[model samples]
Target: MKKDLWIGGEYRSAASYNELKNPYNLELLAKIGSASQEDVRLAISAAHQAKTMMVEMPAFERAEILEKVARFLRDDLDECARLIAMEAAKPLKAARAEVNRTIMTYTFAAHEARRIHGETVPMDAAPGGQGSLAFTVREPLGVIAAITPFNFPMNLVAHKVGPAIAAGNSVVLKPASQTPLSAYRIAEYFHTAGLPAGALNIVTGSGSKIGEVLKKDDRIKMITFTGSPEVGRYIREHSGLKRVTLELGSNSAVVVDEGVQLNKVIPRIVNGAFAYQGQVCISIQRIFVHESIIDEFTEQFVSETRKLKAGNPLEEDTDISAMITRGDVERTKQWVDEAINNGADLRLGGSAEEGIFQPTVLVNVPLNEKVSCEEVFAPVVHINSFRDFSEAIDLVNDSKYGLQAGIFTNDIHKALQAAKKLEVGGVMINEIPTFRVDQMPYGGVKMSGMGREGIKYAVEEMTELKLISFKTE
Candidate 1:
C-alpha cells in the first residue's frame, strides 16, 4: 500500500516517500509520502483556512462527527489492528487492544464535545455590583499541531485529534515516521465521517522538517506532542508563546511490598514490565521489592517472563516482538552489559533470539545505571530490594522522570503515604503504573513534561476561556 499525505481532505503524493516495513520481519508494508517543508506549510495553511468553519460549527455537529468516527473505527477493528501490528511490530493482541482504546477515545470525545461548556457566576456578589450577570464560555484555538509517537500510533493520535475536533479546532498531525499508516488511515475515516475538508491534515515526513515549520507558524495556535524529553524540550523552547502540551519520556517504577500476594502481582508485573516489548512510556523499568519477599518474587517474576511468546507480532499468542528499530535492540544489549559489568545480576534472557530482544530481568542494579535512571524503551527491567515502604518511595522518587509509579500492597496507610510522597504524576496503589484508561486525565511531572491528555482535560487545553457580562448602571 502507498500511504501519502492527507492535505485538505485529499490524498496527495509527495516528491519522495519512505518505506514502512514490518518491524519483525522487514517486509515492505507501505510507502509513506515524505512531505517536504513546503508540503507541511501547505498543510498548516489548510488547517488555518478551515478554522473559521470549525469555529462556526455547533456543538452537536462536532459531537456527531466524532461519533461517526467512533462507529467507523468500531466497525473496522480487525483491519486497524492488522495495520498497527504490521507497522509497529506490536503483538497482534496488543494491537487489537490499542484499536479498542482508540474507539473509546473517539467515543469519549463525542461525549465531551456536548459537555464543552462554561459555568455562570453571579456578579452581584461584589459590593458595587447590581443587576449584573456574568458567565464564561470556551473558545477554540484556531489550529492544533499534533506530533505523536510510534509507540501508540492510533490511540495517541486519537487523544489529540479527537479532542481537537470536539473543541472545534483544526489539527495538522505529524505522526512518527515508523508508524505513519495509522494516522493516514484515521484521516480517511475522518474525511469520510463528514469532517470539514481542512479540519484535519495528516502530514507525512520528517518530524524535524515539519516541526520547524509548525513551531514558527503563527497560524498554529497550539502544539500537542508525545515523544522523548529532548524533543519535548525543544518544542517548549522554540514554540514561542503558542500553547503547547507535551507527553514526554518516563522511566516508570514499581514497588512490591512485603506480604503482598505474590501470585496476584507476579503476572501483572511481568506484563507491565515487558508487554509490547516494553515500548510503552509507562513500562516498568525500576522495581523495588520488599527485602522479605524479594527472593521469591524475583523467582516467580522470572518464571513468568520466560513464559512470554517472543516472535512475529502477527502471531496471536506473541507477547514480545521486535522493537521499533534494530538500534534500540543493540542499545538495550549495551545497557544490559553495562549493568552486568557494574555488578548487577542478569536473571533472565538478555540476548537477541530470532531478531527479537528477549525479555530481560536484572537484580542488584545500581541506582545510577542507565537502565535504572534513564528510559530504557526496551524489554529490560531491574529489581532492587527495599528495606521498608518509606525507603521504597524514596527509591522510586530518585529519578528525573516522574510520569507514574506503582506499589503492590494491602496496607491502606502505606498506600496513602506512597500516594502523597511518590512525586510522580499518578500513584497506583494496587495496580501497575501502566494502568491508564481512555477517560482518565493522564500526564507527567518534572522532566517527564506537562499538560493533561484525557478527552475533557485535552479539550480544556485546546480552548480559551472568554467571559461575558451584562452590566446595568
Candidate 2:
C-alpha cells in the first residue's frame, strides 16, 4: 500500500519514500510518501493561509464536522486498529482499545466546540472606570505544528489535532516515522468529513529536519509535541515565544500499602507495568511496596508477570508483543543487567528472543540504579520496600521525573494525603499510574514537560485570549 502526503486538502505522492515495516516480523506494511523540505514549507504555508477560514467557521459547524469524523472512525475502527497493530506492533486488543479512546477523544472535542466560552471582566469596578465594560474572549491561535510519537499514534494525534480544530486552529501534523499509517488514515477521515482544505495537513519525514522547520517557522503559532524531554527542550529553546504543549517522558511510580489484597491489585499492576511493552509515558516503573507485605506482593506480582504470553502482536491471546525494535529490546536488557550487577534481584523474565523482551520484574532495586532513576521505557518494573508511609511518599518523589504516581490503600485519609502530597501531576488512588481517560487534565510536573492535554484544556492551550473594552459615557 502507498500512503501519500496530505497537504492543502490534496493527496500527493512524494519523490522520496519511506517504507514502513511491522515491528514484530519486519514485514513491509506500506510505502509512506516522505515530505521533502519544500513539502513541509508548503504545509506550513497552507495552514497559515487557511487559518482565517478555520477561525471563521462557526462552532456548531465545527462540532458537526468533528462528530462526523468520530462516526467515520467508529465505522472503520477495525481497519484503524489493524493499522496500529501492524506498524506499531501493539497487540490487537490494545490497538482496538486505542481506537476506541480516539473515538471518544474526537467526540469530546465536538462537545468542547460548543462550550468554548470566555468571561466578562468588571473594568467598571476599578477607580475612574465606572462606565467602562470589558470582556474577554478565547480566540484561536493561527497555525499549530503537531508532532506526535509512535506509541498510541492515532489517539495522541487526536489529542492534538482534535483539540486544535475544536479551538479553531489550523494544524500541520508530523506523525512519528515509525507509525505514519494510522496518522495517514486519520487525515483521510478528516478529508472525507468535509474538513476545509489545509485545515489539517500531514507532513511525514525525518523528525530532525521537519521538527527544525516547524520550530524555526514564525508562522506556526503553537507547537504541540509528545516525545522525549530532550526534544521537548529543543523545541522550547527554538520556538521563540510560540505556544507549546509538550507531553514528555517519565519514570512513574506506585505505592502498595500493607492492607490491600494482593489478588486484586497484582493484575492491575502487572497490566500497568507491561502493557504495550510499557512504552507508555506513565507506565508503572518504580513500585514502592510496604515492608510488611513486600514478600507477599513480590511473590504475587512475579507470578502474574510470568503468565503474560509473549508472541505475535496479531494474535488475540498475546499479552506481551515485540518492542518497537531490536535496538529497544537490547537497551532494555542492558538496563536490567546493569541493575542486577548493582545488586538488584531479578525476580522474573529478563531475556529477549527475536525482538521480544519478556516482561521482567526486579526487587530490592537501589534508588540510584538506572532502572530505578531513569525512564526504563520497557516491559520492566523495579520493586523496592518502604518501611514507613512517609518514606513511601518520599521514595515516590525521589525521582527527577514526576509525571504521575499511584497508591493502593483503603484508607481515605491516606489516599487523600497522597493526592495532595505526591509531587506529580496526578495521583491515582487504588489504581495504577497508567490510568488516564481522554477528557481529564493530563500532564506532569518537574521534567515531565509543560502544559496539559485534555480535550478542553488542550483547546485552551491552542488558543489565546483577547479582551475588548467598551467606554460608555
Put down candidate 2 lDDT per residue, 216-253, tens digits, no spaces. 88999899999999999999888998998899989999
Best-performing candidate as measured by lDDT = 1
Q: What's each prediction's TM-score? A: 0.99, 0.99
Question: What is each predicted model's overall lDDT from 0 to 1?
Answer: 0.93, 0.92
Model 1: per-residue lDDT, tens digit, 128-222? 76788889999999999999999989999999999999999999999999999999889989988899999999998888899999999999989
Model 2: per-residue Cα lDDT at residue 334: 95
**Candidate 2 wrongly placed segments (more than 4 Å):** none
Per-model clash counts, in order, read 0, 0
Clashing pairs in 1: none
Clashing pairs in 2: none
